[model samples]
Target chain A: MEKQVILDPQQFDLTVTRLCHELLEQHADFSNSVLIGLQPRGIHLVSRMLDKLQEILPTPPICGNLDITFHRDDFRRREIPLIPSVTNIDFSIENKKVILVDDVLYTGRTIRSGLDALLTFGRPIQVQLLVLIDRRFKRDLPIQADYIGKSVDTLNHERVKVSWKNIDGEDRVELYIKQTHE
Target chain B: MSSLSVDHLLGIRNLSVDDIERIFQTAQSFKEVINRPIKKVPSLRDITLANVFFENSTRTRLSFELAAKRLSADVINFTASNSSVKKGETLIDTVNNIIAMKVDMVVLRHASPGAASFLSKHTKAKIINAGDGTHEHPTQALLDAFSLREKLGELNGKRIAIIGDILHSRVALSNIYCLQKLGAEVLVCGPSSLIPKGIDSLGVKVSHDLTETLLWCDAANFLRIQLERQDSPFFPSLRDYALQFGLTSEIMESLNKSIIVMHPGPINRGVEISSSVADSSDSIILDQVENGVAIRMAVIYLLAAQIER
Candidate 1:
């Protein structure tokens, strides 16, 4: 396998700030909007975004973590069982503008499951997606992020790894290309 | 990513400690699902399940149905009393006919022992034993243990007394296997006749006194006397049995420490446990019933993933 670092701590910090500036431009004061972090990985990005947004905005937007394990289309199709994470939405999303945040946009299947899971809470007036990294040309579904930090082109055999300081004790993004034998 | 070690949940004896812990972990997630505003998931949208009960059941049947529905699976119920089983149809014939309808799984409860094991060998669909004669009610034991673990943390070394009708109670046997596997100390307390022969060989302590057993344990699971399974009188009379083994609130209040109480339902009200005790705050009988859905959902969800489809 080959590994290449695409973003170090300094570049990652600037990308997050850029995403937060774009979010402020879209949802002005954020009175009628809610922020949702997709569980397992997306939560990290959303947490960092919340801390950054809290500094600029007078009031931080309503936030919750959504787990889409049950709504996934690959229930019995996977080799290993899918374990679910916690879904903690304590506020109502009725007629509110909802922004779904995640660290990476891959095959769009996770976002598809996230959409289905979000509807269970309540009906949202409109929904948008935000991601730190968008892997171009890799989506199985037509899902594009409203707010994007960076876009990278890759093959199916390659993977994108995002590490946070609180979790992996670093702030960096890397691409891993799996070696194959023909 | 974790899957069950076994394809079918035949009994607690067939399960490992890891399998039990996995089910509990999954059930913890499902418990959250059921509490949500929309208590349904699309995990098992394509799977079909048939609840085939050859005997009468109230909670187990409904619990299985609710669990399947919450997972968004297609379900069909079959009761032997109203079905072709009353007209001399064999067990294999009835189940085979159900399987012919493209059923992916069968939750079976029959009067004969090892019925689920028998059906699994012959049928193409996965089998989950709801209850089979006096053998084992694996899900009941699971939910019971899950509820206990929720109230009290980690059952390791905790003394649990299984009181009343050990011989005819499938719950008792399965509980013994499950609790022991989780490192809990188990004591079977009942009349000598109902306590079964050579039960100590299973590594559980046997006692015949109710008060003594209560004083010696952390939790007491009071089982209803299986009057339907009793061929002859095990004791003198219902009054005499109540005087000896009935769990009343008075008995609970007399204890130095408050112990958790449980009952796998269709409680024999005034006989095995009084109404006051069953309704008291100390009892987790209702939580046991509620956890029943989550535990069954976890079992079916895990087993369904193992299906070739």
Candidate 2:
């Protein structure tokens, strides 16, 4: 496998700051607007964004973690079972403008499942998607992210990996390309 | 491991400590799912389940049905009294008939010891032994252990006493296997007649004294005296049995340290345990019932994920 650094630590912080600025411009003060982080990986990015946003804004919006394992389309279609994570939304999302956050936007199935999971809490006035990295042309569903930090084009055999400073001890995005053996 | 080692949950003996831990972990997630506003998930939406009870059941049947429905699975219920088993239909034929209708799983409760094992060999659907005579009630034991672990942090080095009928109650046997496998010490306390032969060979201490056994353990699981399974008198009388073995409030007051009380109900109120003690804060009988749904959901979800698409 061939590894290539897509975003270094300095660029990663700048991208998060730019994304939070875009969110502040649109949702202005974030009143009646909430952010929901997809579980396992998305929560890391969401918490980082929340920390950056709170530095400038007076009030932070209600943020929660949502797990979509039970709402996935591929329930029995896989070889192994999908383990669920903790969904810790304590407040209501009724008639709120909800932004669904994730680390990477891949096949768009996770967002689709997230949409279904979000409805179980309550109906939202509007729902939008946010991602740190968007893999262009790899979507299997008719879904798109409203906010994107960076968009990269790649082949299906290549992968995108995101690391956090708190978790992986560094903030970096790397692309892993499978080497051909022919 | 993501999946269970055995496809069918026939008994606790077939499950390893890893399998039990996985079940408890999955159940912790489902417990949150059920407490939500919707109280349902779509994991098993395309699958169909059949509750095939050859014997009578009220709680177990309702628990299984609710668990299946909560996962968004279609369910069909069958009871022996109303089914073709009365017309001489064999167990395989009944199960095969259900499987012919595209049922993916069978939750079975029969009076025979190995009826679940028998159906698993003859039928094509996955089998979950709801209760197989005096053999095993694996799900009940799972929920009981799950509830106990919730009240108590872990089962390692914890002392648990199984009180009351051991010969006729399948719950006791399943609990013994489950609690012991989780590293808890077990002691079966009852009259010599009700205690089965060679129970000590299962590696659990046997005692006839209730107070001494309760004093020795951290938790006491009092079982219901099954009069339906008793062919002849195992003890002198219900009054005599209550006087000797029943968990009364006086016994609760006598114990220096408070012990957790548990009962797998349709509790024989005032027979094996008094009503006050069963309803006490230390008693987790109702939590066991609530955990039953989540445990069954985890079991079915894990097994259904392994089914060939």
Candidate 3:
């Protein structure tokens, strides 16, 4: 198996800071803007973005982590799913703009489930999707990312894995393609 | 395996030491949350939890329901008498219907011992065994353990005696497993018939005399008589059982001064334990009830996390 690096550690940080600034500029008032990070990698990304937002603006956005395992579409097909991390959103999302953050956008099923889970809290005025890497694959739903770091063209069987030094002890993006046995 | 997940909490017998400790630590976190002014957490927000009670239970059912709600999870209450189960539907069918509604967890209390385990195996939703027959009440045991840990600082080397109808009380069975796992010497005291044979295999001592058992323990857990057990040949009469095994004020005073009294209650005032002892300073019955919610919160939270992975 061969692994290819797309983004280095420093490059990833700059892209995230740029995304944070762009998001801050869009929600200029910052009164009803909140960031909800999807669990695992997105949580760390949200934390980093939150830190950058605090330095740029007088007040930072309210942030939370969400685990959408229970709301997955293929729950019956799996043997028992492992418990995910806690979803901590203290403020109500009613009439507020929620920016859902994730590390990678693959099939978009996770974001769909995240939307389903978020609806149970309250009705949001709008929800915008954000992803570090937007691999151009056929999405099962009509959903598309509002803010994308980079668009990468890839085959259907290939996988892109993002590792952060703060989380996975390294900062790199690796792409792995499925191998066919002869 | 790097991680383990329980589909349901049927009993403590099958639980590993690490699993029990994880629940305790999670409950400890909720205990801190309980002391806060808000008294709620967003850990389980947007999740839906269903409480399915086949038998009537005010204390156990309410505690679990409140625990779920306090976690910001939406709760749906289902009673056997009001549901299709009363219309001759089987327990499995009823549970399956709830699962179809996409509930995240099910807190069940059935009159059968392995009911929770059965439901857990059948459903995708997580199960918390509230009380099932005389089999086991894992949450009650967790609460009992929590209360003991609060008072004694640790469960190691504590001599605890569970007194009264062991054969018909799920609390006794659960406490036995939990206490033994936590490094406590457990003693069972009651009429010979109510004490199951071969209970010593569980590393617990059996004593027929209450006075002797009281003298040898630091805590006494009294179990209530199941009115349904009265017809069985287990005992001659309720009066006789009371006179022989009951904890009167005088009987309590005769024991070691530091001994704590406990009962998984809705107490039969003067039947198994005296009213004086129940309300005394040495009694932790209320503490057990209060800890029930926190422990259950921990169980749901940990189990939910595992299922998410």
Candidate 4:
């Protein structure tokens, strides 16, 4: 097994700043748009994005936290049980632009579940995906992110993990490679 | 699903504390699933369930049916009146016929005690006991605990007084089994004759005095007194029973502490609980009914996880 550090603490901060700026470029006033962070892992990423968005705009629109555990495709196929997080979308998503935020985009199955779960609140005029890490050439679905912080090419046996400062004690991106033959 | 001890949910007696926690945790997820706009999930897709009710019921049967349907499982319902049970067919024979049709699970409500467990041994399909005759209603107790946890946060060290006819109550037996497992102190309060013999041996306090029990408890579950089940008089008369045990607003105010009020269903109104006390904010009878679906769904999902085919 091997490990690769794609982004250090300084690089991760820059990526967060750039992604927040990219978000503000499309949604300037945020009048008809709202931010939603996918549940469990995405909640931390969304709060970080919100902290960055607050620097640009004094008052940001309400943010939603969505749980896609029940809507996932491999619910029965998986060996481990799925525990669902809370879906805290107080405001309606009707006819509003929604940006779904997550930490990583790999097989795109999570994003697909998020998309299915998002419609349960209300029909959105437009929907976009924002991820901190984009694992290239390994999508089980045809979905693509509208906003991405960094894209990395990895093998099928490789795993991309985004660590947060609060949870994991530091901010960084690392890839774990399995050494089956070596 | 990782540590689920039993393949079938026959009673709370066989369930470990971890199994109860797992069921409650899974029910919490299913509760969230029902709040969605689509109101349906495909988790139980390709699974089939049959609801076999050999006894009369309203809430438990419908709750199990709705829970199965919400999980996207194909459901077929059978009642004693409409089925061959009326023609003297045995329980195993009737259930085996349904299992032969490739049904995955069975939610059964029978007047005979241990009917689900008996069927579980004879048939390959998983069995869930909605309610057995004076035995244990596992799902009912789970939902009651779920509702109590919602109101009181957790069951640990909480005092719960289950008041009414314990002799005939499947609910009391099951609730005692579950609440004790969840670390709640249980008190069985009822008329001396109405309280079952040896109920005190199950690690719960038994008392006929209502005020003393109410003062010592945080929640009170007033079980319906089945007049039909009492062939010989347990109490002197209805008026005597009501005067002694009926929960009134005056009794509620005398407690001087906030307490949760719960009842199974089909309330006798002025008999067991007065209208004022039953309609008060403390009464979570409706929440108990709603959580029934989620609890049943959790039981089915966890049990089905162990099914090989």
**How do all models score by TM-score?**
0.96, 0.97, 0.65, 0.96
lDDT of 2 by residue, B131-246 (tens): 99999999999999999999888999999999999999889999999999999999999999999999989999999999999889988999999999998999999999999999
**Chain A in model 2: its TM-score?**
0.97
Report the lDDT tens digits of candidate 4 across residue range A1-182.
Answer: 78999899999999999998898899997888999999888889889988888877968767989988777877656675455678888788999999999998899999998998889778999999999999988899999999999999998878888899999999999999887875
User: What is the Å distance of residue A39 in model 2 from its true position?
Assistant: 1.9
* Backbone clash pairs in model 2 (N, Cα, C under 3 Å; residues 3+ apart or in different chains), count: 0
**After TM-score superposition, what is the CA distance of residue A63 in candidate 4 from its true location, in Å?**
1.5
Ranking by lDDT: 1, 2, 4, 3
Task: State the lDDT of candidate 1 residue by residue for B137-245, as single tens digits.
Answer: 9999999999999988999999999999999989999999999999999999999999889999999999988999999999999999989999999999998999999
Across A1-182, the per-residue lDDT of candidate 1 in tens digits comes to 88988799999999999999999999998999999999989999999999999999998888999999999987766653478889989998999999999999999999999999999888999999999999989999999999999999988989999999999999999999887889
Q: Over the stretch A81-158, how does candidate 2's per-residue lDDT look in tens digits?
A: 467889999988898999999999999999999999999888899999999999999999999999998999988989
List, for all models, the DockQ compared with the true complex: 0.68, 0.65, 0.05, 0.51
Question: TM-score for model 4?
Answer: 0.96
TM-score of chain B of 1: 0.99
Task: Candidate 4: list runs displaced more than 4 Å.
Answer: B1-3
Candidate 3 residue-wise lDDT, B114-173, digit = tens: 999988888888888888988999999989988888888888999999998898889998
True contact recovery of candidate 1: 0.68
Name model 1 segments beyond 4 Å from true. A179-182
- Please write out the lDDT profile of model 4 over residues B1-309, one tens digit for every residue: 383788899999999998999889989888877776767777778789999998889998899999999888899999889878778899999999998999999999988898888988999898999888999999999999999999999899999999999999999999999999999999999898988888778999998999999999999999999876788998898889999998999999988898899999889999999999899998998889889889888888788777774
